[model samples]
Target: MTATATAAVIAPAPEAAPALRDTRPLRLITCGSVDDGKSTLIGRLLWDTKAVKEDQAAALNRDSGKQNDLGLPDFALLLDGLQAEREQGITIDVAYRYFATDKRSFIVADTPGHEQYTRNMATGASTADLAVLLVDARAGILEQTRRHATIATLMGIKQFVLAINKIDLINYDKARFDELSLEFKEIALSLGVKQVTAIPVSALKGENVVYDGKASMPWYEGPTLVEVLELATVRSAQTVGFRLPVQRVSRPGESFRGYQGTVAGGAVKPGDSVVILPSGMVANVKQIVTFDLVRNAAVAGDAITLVLDRQVDVARGDMIATIDAQPQVGLAFDAQLVALQPGGIEPGKRYWLKSGSRRQRVSVQPSSLLDLKSGKWNRHDGALPMNAIGKVHLSFDEAAIFDAYELNRTTGAFILIDPDTNNTVAGGMISAKRGDLGGLNNEAERVILSLPADLADKILASGILSERRDEIDIRRTNPGRAAELLGELDS
Candidate 1:
C-alpha cells in the first residue's frame, strides 16, 4: 500500500533580527596634512549618516553654486561653517559635528590641517578616543601626517584609522593602498599604537566612508569607517582609583556645604574615606549630590557636589582622593610637551601650568626635542620651537599633585600659559616625579620626624603638614632605626 505523501510543512522565516546598536557616542577627530580633504571627509560622514537636515542641505546647495560631477554638493561646505573658511576653501578652526547610525553614534571634530594650526589639531585630539588620520593616496605620507599621528598618540589616543582618501585619483589600485597601509602601520607601531585600521576611500565620491564601495573596489572586504568606530572602546578614567579635584567649594546656605568637581579618576561612594590634598585632611563622604538627585556613588566623568561628614578646609585646586591611594605629591616633575606657539618654549622660562582645575607657576627647562620625521629625541638644551615635541622638567614653586600620565590622564596632563602673552604655549603630560638631581638620581632630602605613629597620624589628620607635605618625607622605621636616625641628626 502506497502511503499518501505526508503533508509538508515549512517553518516560517524567522523575523529579521533587530539590528544591534551602540547608543554610547564615540568621540573622534579627523586630522591630516593641508588639503587632505578633512572637511570633505567629515561632511561626507554627516551626509551619509543623515545628520544633515533638509534646510541645511538646501543651504549647502545654495552656498555651493556648483556641484561635483557625481551631483553631490560641495561636502566641505557642510563643515567649513565660517565665511572666511568658505572663502579660502580651508578649515581654520576645529568644527564639531554629531551624527549617528544603526550601529553607533559619533561626535567628530574636523580639525584644521595646516602646519600652523597644529595647535588646533592638538586641541581636538585632546578629548578624542580615536583619531581618523587622513592622507591623499596621490601624496602618500606627509610630514604633517606624522606630526598629527605623534600628537594623537601623545594625547593618549590608541585607536587610529588611516583613511587613504582620494583613492579614485589613483584608480583605486590595491597595490597603492597596500603600500601606504604598510608604511603607515610602521609609523603607528613606532608611536606605540597597535590598533590601526587602514581603509581605501575617495571622500569626494563617498567610497568606503559611511558606505561600502563594493562596486568600485570589490577587493576590500573589511568594514567601513563607521564600523570601526562602532566597535572601538571608549576611553575611560575608571581604570585608576578615585580622584576628585575640587573646582570650587559650594556653600549655598549655612545648612549645606559641598565640594563641586568632576571625578577625575575612579569611583567614590557615600561612605568612602577620602583625603583632601595639600592639607591632608581626612573625612568620610556623606553624600554624592547632583542637581537632579542625591546619588549613592559617583564615578569618573561624573560632575557632582560631594558632601562630607564634616567640614574640612577644602578649596579650589585641591584634590580629594581615596586615602589609601593618594596621587603623587611633589615639588618637581618630568614631563613631555608639545610646543604650540612661535615663541617656542624657552629654557628657564616660568609659565602658568593649569592641570585639572589647579593653576600654578612652574619653571620649565627644556631637555630634549623630538624629531617627528626621524622619530628620535635629539639632545637639545635650547628653546623648543613651534610644533616641537620635547622633554622638560617642571619645578613648581609650591606643592604640586599629579599622577603618571600613563596611569591617569585627567590628573597628569596640563597646559602651559605664557605669562607675558597670557596665551597657551604648550600642552604637556607628566612622566614621573623628579628627584633632587633631576630624574637620574633617586637621592632626596629626608626629614626624619620622630613621633609616635598615633601622634603622627593625628598631626596628618590635623592638616598642619598639608602646606609642607611635599617638602616633608615621612618614613616608617623600626624603633632601632628611628633612634639611630635621631642620634645622627643630633650629632
Candidate 2:
C-alpha cells in the first residue's frame, strides 16, 4: 500500500490524545504569487498558536507603529520587515520565522510571493521538508501558483499543503472549495507532487489556522492545520543519508577546535568511521562536540563539533561522510536551471559553485534547455533565458562529492554565486553526469582541456556578454582560442 493510502487507513485511532507524538521538527517554506497572503498565513499560524509573544503582539497593535490601509493590523507586516516590502505591500525577499506548537517545532521560511523572487522561493524550498503553497481562493490558481508548485517539486519538497486562502470571500462554500481543490489536484499531480491536502483557510481572519476547526467549517473532515503539521512525516524524509558538508573549521582560540555546521542528514555517532570525500581520507569520529556540551552521537539539527581521530586536511567546502556511503565526485555535472537575473549564463563563465560547504569555480556549457512550463527537454538550445529551466552540462574547476539532489537536498543541491558580488545567482539539483548523453562526457572534455592557462582564459571569456561583444557574439567566439593562447605561455 502507498504511504498516502496508509495514512488514510490510520485516520481513526482509539484514543483522543494527540495523534502525533513525534517532536521531530519540520522546516516549512510558504510560497505563492504576490498578494497571495504568504506572510499573513505565517503570521496567522504564529498568532493562533500563541507562539508570538505578548509584547510583540502588543507592539503591532500600538497606534504609533501600525501599518497598512486596512488599519486592522497589517498582519503580513509582522514578517515583511524590509522597508520596500511593507511600502509596496509585496514580499520582495525570503524571511525566516520560528514557531512551535506542542506537537511540532517549525522553522518557517516565508518567501517572497513576487514572480521575480522565484529564485528566493527555490532557495527557501531547497531546504524545506514540506511546502505550504497558498492560493487565493477568490482568484483560484494563477500562473504564480503553478510556477511555485512546479518549482517546489523541482527543489525536492516531498510533501505539500495546498492552502486555498481567502475562503471568507468565497462565502465558506463547500462547492467552491471542492472545485478549487479538484483543479489544483490535477496541476499538482501533473508536476509529480504527492499527498496534497487541500484546505480552506482565512489567514487574515485566523479561521482553522491552529484550532477552532469545529466552528469554521464542519464539512471539512481532515485534521486542523496544526494537526497535519504535527503528524506529517518530516523526520523520515530528512533522515535519508549521512551528509556532512564542512561549512568551516572551528578553532576558537587555543582551548578547543572542531567542525561547525548543522548536520545535513542521517545520524553520526562517536567512533563512526567516516570518509572525507574528493580526498578519500578515512577517520574515526573521535568525538561530537558542541557549544558548552559534548555528545556520543549527533543527528540532524545538532550544530555540534565533530572531532576526528586524526587531523585530516579539512576545511570549508569539503564533505565528510560515512565511509560506506561516501558521495560521488566529479568535475563535470548536468543541472536543470532557471535563470532569474538579467544576464544569460553560458559556457566558460566562472560562477561560484556552492554544494553543502564546498564552494569552487564552475564553468557552464549549455547542452540543452527544458521548457519548464511544457516539461519538455530542448537540447541544442545553447542558452538558458530568464525563468527558463533547461538541462545544462557544467564543468567544475574542482572535484567535489555530490549526492543526488533527490536523495539528500542539503548535500545534493547547489547554488551558483556571482563571482563579482558573491550573491547566489542560480539554484541547481545535481541530476546525473552527462555520460548519459550519446558519446559526450563533460568530465572527459574538461580533463582534455585542464591546462591552467586554458581554464583561466575560458573563465575570463565566459558569460552573457564580455569585454569584447554581445551574448550571441560571445557564444560564437571559439573556445579553442584559449588552447591556442596557451602556446603563448609555453613559448
Candidate 3:
C-alpha cells in the first residue's frame, strides 16, 4: 500500500502547542532532489491547516480521479497546478501557497527539485526566511541536496530544516534518522548555518508535519514541522542603514517632484539627511508619500515616494541613502555568482549588471569555481557553466554601487543580463570592493604597449580598450623628449 493508504489505517491524536507562537508569516522554500515529495509535503500542510477551500478540495478530488484508502485526494495535485506538471507528475516552476494556523501564517514556495530548474529555486529562496530541504530517508544525501543547501546559504538563509522524509519506508528507523541528522548538521555548519532542525517525517501520511506521529514512532520526541516554523526567527534588515534606489521621478505636476522606490534597507523620515549616489548630491527628506496616508517614516520593504527639501538632479538608477552610511562605490568589485543560463558566464565578456533600479555595463573575470561535492573553491579562470557557482571580479564602465551581501542582502544582490540575448545569465552577490588593485603600483612591473599611431587608434576604437582607457597613459613621442628619456634610461 502507498504511504497515503497506510495513513488511513492509523488514528491521529489530539494536537497541542509546543511553545509560545510568533505571529509573523514565515516565508520558506521547500526544495530537494526530484521525487523527494516537496509537492506532497506542501499539499499536506495546506490540507491539514484547512487552507484549501471546499471547492478547491472538490476540484482536486475530481482532477485526481482516484482517492487513497484514507479517502485523501492526491495531495500533490493541489500544488502541481500547471497542466504540464499535472501531466508529468512533477513541479516545473515555483508554486507559492498561503496557509495559516492559530499562532502564525505562512507563505511557502514549492520549488522544483530538478537540477535544471535550480534557477527557479534560487528565485524563490531569495526572499525566504527559512529553507526546508527534503531528502528520502533511504537515499541519505545526494549532490542535488548539497547544491540546494549551498544556494540557500548563498542567498542569505540561516535557518534550515532537514526533512528526512519517507521515514515510514525505513520502518520508522531511529538509527537512520540519527545518522542523516548528524551528517546534515556537519553540512549546515560548513555553510555557516547554525540553526538546523532535523525531523523524520512521512509527508505522504501527514506524520510529524502538522500533527505528531507518536502512534507510529513513539521513540521520536521532536516538534512537528508546523511547530518549528511558528518559532523560527524572521530575517530583519534594520541593521543596514536606509537605502532607496530611485525607480522613477514622479512629475505629476511641475511643483510636485517626488522620487519613487521601495526602501531597500533601514528607515527614512522627514528632515533626514540623504545623499544621491554616483552624483553624490545631498538633500534632506521633505515627506514620505504613499497611496494611503502620508507615512511619517518608511522602513525597509516600504514602497513610498520621497520628496526632498531642495531641487536636485536626481534621476532613475540613482540611490538615496543615509550620508553617514553609504553603499560601496567603485569601478571594480569582487562577487560570487551562480550561472543560470545554458550559455554560461564567459570570462572577459561584457554583460549588463542590474542592481536595485540601476543597470550598467560590466565585464566579468572568473576567479574560482565552487565544487559542490567537496564544498571547496577550486582554482579556475574559465567559463562558468550553467548551475555552477564561481567567484569573479566585476569591472564596470561607471561607478557601481553595492554592499557586501553578508552585511545587507538587499543592497548586495544583483543579476547579470546577457547583452546579445537579453536573458539573465547569472545571479550574483557582492563580496567586497576591489580596493586599490589599481592603486599606486610598482612602475617597473608595468607592461608598456607601443604601436604605430594608426594601429593604436584602431585598437582604441575597437571597443576592446574602451573600458580600460582611463587606466592607460599615452605619451606622444618626439625627437626632443624621446632622446632625453633615452639618455636618462641609459644613466
Candidate 4:
C-alpha cells in the first residue's frame, strides 16, 4: 500500500458489474486479525488518493506515534483516529472513510480486528458491497482471517480481495504469494464465494495498492487493488419482491397522508398493488413524494414518502410489499446468527428482535454451531459462546414476517438485543419459515398431529388442501416422533 506518489487516473468500468453506477459509491470494508494492517491498508489508500487534506496530513505526520523505517510517516494514524486506539496501537471501533478515483467513488469501513470487537466488524460488513481481507504476509492465514471471511460471506458479499499485507517483510516472495492466494481461494470456494482476488501489498511502503509494484517483482502481472474495486459488481438484483419497512406515517396536514421509508428491496411504481404486512391489507400506490421531485417510480435505497390509494391504518413497523411476491408470514422461523458479546446467547431467553424498524420479543434456541476451523456446522448445546456462529429457532408470540436471507437481505436480516442489558447480543439472517405451536382458534378442537417436515411439505405443495391450509396446522418433527404420533391416533 506504500510507494512513490502518482497522479490519480480514471479506470474503465469493471466487467463484473451489470452497469457502472455513478449515483452510489462502491461500499467496502477492510478487515482481518489483530495487527493485520487493516488500518494501514485503508490509510495508505486514502493518502494515495489524496483523500487526506493538507492540514490533516500535517497533523497525521505530527501525531504519528512511531514512524516506519521506510521514511514514511505511520499511515495508520489517518484511520486510527480514536485516542484509545492510538494509545493501545490497535483498532477498537469501526472507522469509515470516503475517497474517489477518476473512475469511481468508494466508501471504505476500517473495522476492528480484535475478537472482542467482532460485533463492530459485523456492523461494518452489513452494508458493504465487497470485503478486502488483509492478512500479514509473514503470518499467512490466521483463524481470525477465516472468521472475518466467513462473516463477510454470510453478509452476502461475494467479491473478496485477499490483501497479503507486509509482503515486503517476506522479501516479495512470489511462491509465498501464490501459496497464500491458493489457500484463501480454497477457503473462499468452500464458503460459496468464487470472486476472489489476491493482491500483495505493503501498506507502509505502498507497493501494489494504488501504485504498481512491478519494480520489486517483475513476475507479478495482476491489477492493483484499485483496479479490481473499480470493476466489481455494485448493484444487487437477487430479490424478486419489493419491501418497504415503514419507518413512520407522514402527515403534515389532515388532507394528505403518506407512509415514509427507504425502499429496502425491489422496485415500485404507481398503481402497484401492495399488501400491508401482518394485517395483510391491500392498497395501491398513488404517488411517490421526494424532496427533489414527485417521482413516478422508486427502487431499493430510495427514500420517499409513498401515498396509498386509500387509508388502511398503516403504522410504524409495518411492511409494504408487492402482493404477488409477498414475504413469508408465520409464527416461527429458523435463523443463523453470530453470538457477539461476551455474555453470548442464552437459550430460551426472551430478547428483542429488531428487523428493519420493527422490534419485538422472541425466544431463541440454539441448534448448531459453525466450526470455522473445520468449516462445518456441528450440533451444539442450546447455549452459544461469544464469537460463535450458530443456527437457531426463533419462536414468536405473534406473527413473524421475513424472506429467507438468500431472497431479500433487508427483510431477512435481524439483530437480537438483550432486554436486561439493552445491548445487541447477536446479528442474524432468516433461513426459512417453519411451523409453530398451535395458532389454531381453539386448543380443545386442535389435533396435535406431528409429521416429517418433507412429508408435510409435499402434502401442502400438492394443492389438495390449498383452500384450507390455515385450518390444518403443520408442525415438523423427527421421523420416529411422527410415527409414534400416527400410532397413538389410530382408530
Candidate 5:
C-alpha cells in the first residue's frame, strides 16, 4: 500500500492521551540504555498479568537452559524473538507487545536500549502516554539515562516511572536503593516530568516486578511494579482535543468512500458540523463509522471512517474536526526540533512536515540552537547538529492548522522529513509564533506585497481583515512608497 494509504488505515493518536480510567487501553513506550532489562521487565509484567500465552511460556522455559543453570525461563526471549537479538542478547529493533490486565489493556513498544539507537527510542516514546524508564541499579544514573530522560521530556512524555532494575546485584540494600532513587528523582524532576515513581526490581528474578517474592527485601514499603502501573492515576495526563487528520479518502465498491482515521480526542457524532483545515471547507459529519461498528458518538482512540454529509472535495493531508475547536492556521510558527544523526539541518533546505496523517512541504530557517547539556538556547549555529535540540522558525509551502504542543499534542507535535530521502530528519513541537512576540501592528505589516493572488486571497480570508486591506493597498501603490508606508505602519 502507498504511504498515504497505510497512514489512512493506521490511525495516529493525537496529543492528549485518554484518562487512565477511560475505556481505551493505555499505550506505553519503554526506553532505556543497553542491558537495562527493558524487555525482561516488560516480559515479567506480561507473565504476571497472565497475558502470556501457554505456548510462549513453554518455549521460554525450554530455550533458557544455560550450561549450569537449567530450566530457568529466558523472559527476554519472549520479546527479543529475532535470532540476532538472541545471539547478541541485546535489542536492535523495536518490538511491539500487546497485553492487558483487568484494569487496563496496553500497547508497549519495546525500543532498543543502546545510546546509538537513541533515535529509535525517541520514535517509540513520542506517542507514549507514560514512559517506563529502566535504569540499572548497578550502573546508577549514567549519561544514557540522562539522555533518555531528556528525549522523553522533549518528546512530551509527562508521566515517568523509573524502574530501577537488577536490584539483586546490589543485595537489595535499602541504602543503595534509597540513594539511587533520590538521585534519579532529582534528575526526573529537573526534566519537568510530572510524575516519578521509583521501584526496585530484579527483572532476572522477578522481584518486585510482579508479586515481589518474600525472599526479596521485605523492608521495602513501596507497591510492586504491577500495582503502581495498574493504580497510578495520571490527571490532566493528555489533552482530549478533537484532531483527526484525514489519512485517506476511500471509495469502496461503489461511490461510498469516506475519510478514515483514528480519533485523537473529543467525540464525533453524526450531524456534527465540522471544518476541513488549510482549506477551511465546512461539512457535517454524516456518520460516525467503522468497518465493524457504526455509532452516534465516537470518543477518543476510536479508529473509524467518517462519512461526511457532502463530498466537499476532501483529500489526504486534510484534517476534519468539529467547528467549535478549530486548529490554529499559519505557515510560520516556532518549533523545537531534535536532530538524531550527525548531519545538521540546512537553513534553506526543504523538508516534509508530518503531523498526524497530514504532510506539508516546508523550509527550515534557523532560529536558536538549544544546548542539551547546558540547557540553554543559543544564537544561530548555522544549522542544528546531531543529538541536538533547537528551536527554528519553519516556513511552510502552505498554511496548516496546528495547536501549541503545550496545549494539544495531536496538533502541536510534528515530524520533519527529508523531501529527497523521505527519512524523518527531525522531531519537532510547536512552541509559539515569532510574531506573537511583538505588537499587533508589526505583525500586520510584515507580509510581502508581491505574494501570488491566491495566497493574498487566503491571507484576506484568514479574518485578519486589517492586514488584508493593508496588503491590497500596498500592492496597488509604488514599491518605494509601499516600503515607507509599511515602516510607518510598523512604527
Candidate 6:
C-alpha cells in the first residue's frame, strides 16, 4: 500500500479544484544536485506544454549530438544557451524561463546545482514562491540537495515539489520512490517545511511531467508537474498595512512632485494616512499617478507615483507606510545572510544595506554560522566565509526601517554591498527588531528566557508555550552564556 505521507502537501484532485483561481503568475525555481536533470526537467516541461516552437525544436535536433535512452534529443540544450555550456554539458548560471498554460502562467528559475554556485541558487530562491527540488532516483539525496533545500526554506519558499527524476533508470520501482519520499519528508520536517509533494518522474522520457504516467506506473495516482504549479500560491498572503519604498522622487515641473515606486505590501488609496520613515513625517495621499492614468487604488506589486497632500521631506531611501501598521524603525536588527563573495563578511565592517529601494550604511557583526551537515546553527565569531550562511547583527548609523521577513518579504529582505568595490557581497533576511516588545507597557510584565537554541526552538514550538507566545520572549544564546544565566537564576 502507498503510504499517505504526502497528505500534508496541498495537492487536490483536478476536478475538485476551485473554479476561481488567482491569475498572478506563479514564480518557482528548479534546484537540486548536479546531474539531477534540473535543466532537462524544465526543457521537458516546455516541450510537452507546447512552449517550444518549430524552429527551436529543429535547432535542438540539429545541434544535439547526444540523445537519451528514449532516442530523444538532449532536451537540456534548450536552457544551456551558452556555447561553452553546451560543450561542457553543465549549467553555469541561473536561467529564467517563462511559459504559460491555459489554466495559469509560470516563471521558473533553473538554478545551478554546484556547491560553488550556491550563491546563484540563493539569488533565484529569494523571489521564488515555490521550489521544485529534483532528486535522482538511484542516488536518493545528496549534500547539494540539502544545501539547496536549506537555502530555499530560509529564503521563505514554503511550498516544495520533490521530483524524483530518472525513475526509469531504477526500473520505475515503486519501492524506491516510496523510500525517497519518506526520507525527504523527514528532512523537510526538520527544516520546518510543512507543505511538500513528492512525485516520481523520468525527465528523459517525459513521464509524469505534463501528462499522466499511468501506463508506466499504474500504482501511483497523483497530479502532474504542471497541475501542481497551476495551483501553487505565492508567499505574500500574510501581509500587513501598506508599504511604498520610495525609489526616486519625480518632479517634472515645480507644480508637480510625485513619489515614485512599487507598492511592496498592503494597499493605498487617495486620502489614506501615510507616514514617512526615518523622518517620521505624516502625510495624506492626494493623488496616485501612473504613466497611463491616475489609479484610484494601488495594491502590492503595483508601480505608481504618489502625490502627498502636504509637503514632506521625502527622498530616495525613505519608506512610505500606513501610520498604524508601520514597519519597525530602529538602529539595530538581527538577520541571517549568505556571504556571496570570496572575501566573505568581515565583522565590524560598514557596508551599504539595500532593502527594497532604500540603501543605507550599516555595520555587520557575525554571531553564528549554520552547519548544513548538522542542521544546526553553531556559535561563531569573526568574518563569515564565502558561500557561508551565517546569522549576524546589523547596526545602522541612522534609524533603519524594516518588517520581519516572515511578515513581509519585500520590506524585510536586503543585500549588503561592499563599500570599496561597489559589488554586492551578501543577501540577507531580517529576523526581528533588536529590542521590540509590541504593544507592551511598563505596567505589563513580560518573561525573557535565554536558552540553548535547540531547546528554545522546541519550547517555542510546543503547544503550552505557543498559547502565550506573545507574553514571553525567548532568545537563543551560546552555551557559555546560557550556563551563566542559569547560574545567576539559581543564585
lDDT tens digits by residue: candidate 3, 315-432: 8998998865777777888899999999999999999999989999999999899898888899999999999999999999999889889788888999999999999999999988
Residue 192 miss distance in model 2 (angstroms): 1.9
C-alpha lDDT score of every prediction, in listed order: 0.87, 0.73, 0.87, 0.86, 0.74, 0.87
Ranking by lDDT: 1, 3, 6, 4, 5, 2
Which has the better TM-score: candidate 1, or candidate 5? 1
TM-score of 5: 0.77
Winner on lDDT between 3 and 4 is: 3
Can you write out model 5's per-residue Cα lDDT over 165-209, one digit (the tens) per residue? 888888887898889889877777777775888888888778887
Model 2's number of clashes is 4
Please give the lDDT score for candidate 1.
0.87
Per-model root-mean-square deviation over C-alphas:
6.7, 13.5, 13.9, 9.8, 11.9, 12.2
Quote the lDDT for 413 in model 6.
Answer: 95
Give the TM-scores of the predictions, in the order they appear: 0.87, 0.75, 0.84, 0.85, 0.77, 0.84
Off by over 4 Å in 6: 1-22, 436-491
TM-score for candidate 1: 0.87
Candidate 3 pairs with clashing backbones: none
Q: Point out the worst 10-residue segment of candidate 4 by lDDT.
A: 1-10
Worst 10 residues of 6 by lDDT: 436-445
**Residue 25's lDDT in candidate 2:** 69
Report clash pairs, candidate 1.
none
Model 2, CA-based lDDT: 0.73
What is the per-residue lDDT of model 2 for residues 1-491, given as tens digits with 9 covering 90 to 100?
A: 69999877776654534655456668889998778898998988888777778788887677225454445666787788888886887888889888887666888999987777777887788778888888888887887777788788888776889888888787888898899889888877787776888888888877777864557688988766777787677634354556678888988787566777788888899877677766766677888887778787887667877888787888877777765455667767767666776565666678888776677888877777655455555675465666656567677666757777777777777878889877666778877655424334443322222223345556446541244332111111134655564556456
Check candidate 4 and list the clashing pairs.
1-202, 1-206, 2-205, 2-206, 2-207, 3-206, 14-231
- Runs with alpha carbons beyond 4 Å of true place in candidate 2: 1-21, 63-72, 212-218, 235-241, 247-262, 286-294, 303-316, 367-380, 436-491
Superposition TM-score, candidate 6 onto the true structure: 0.84
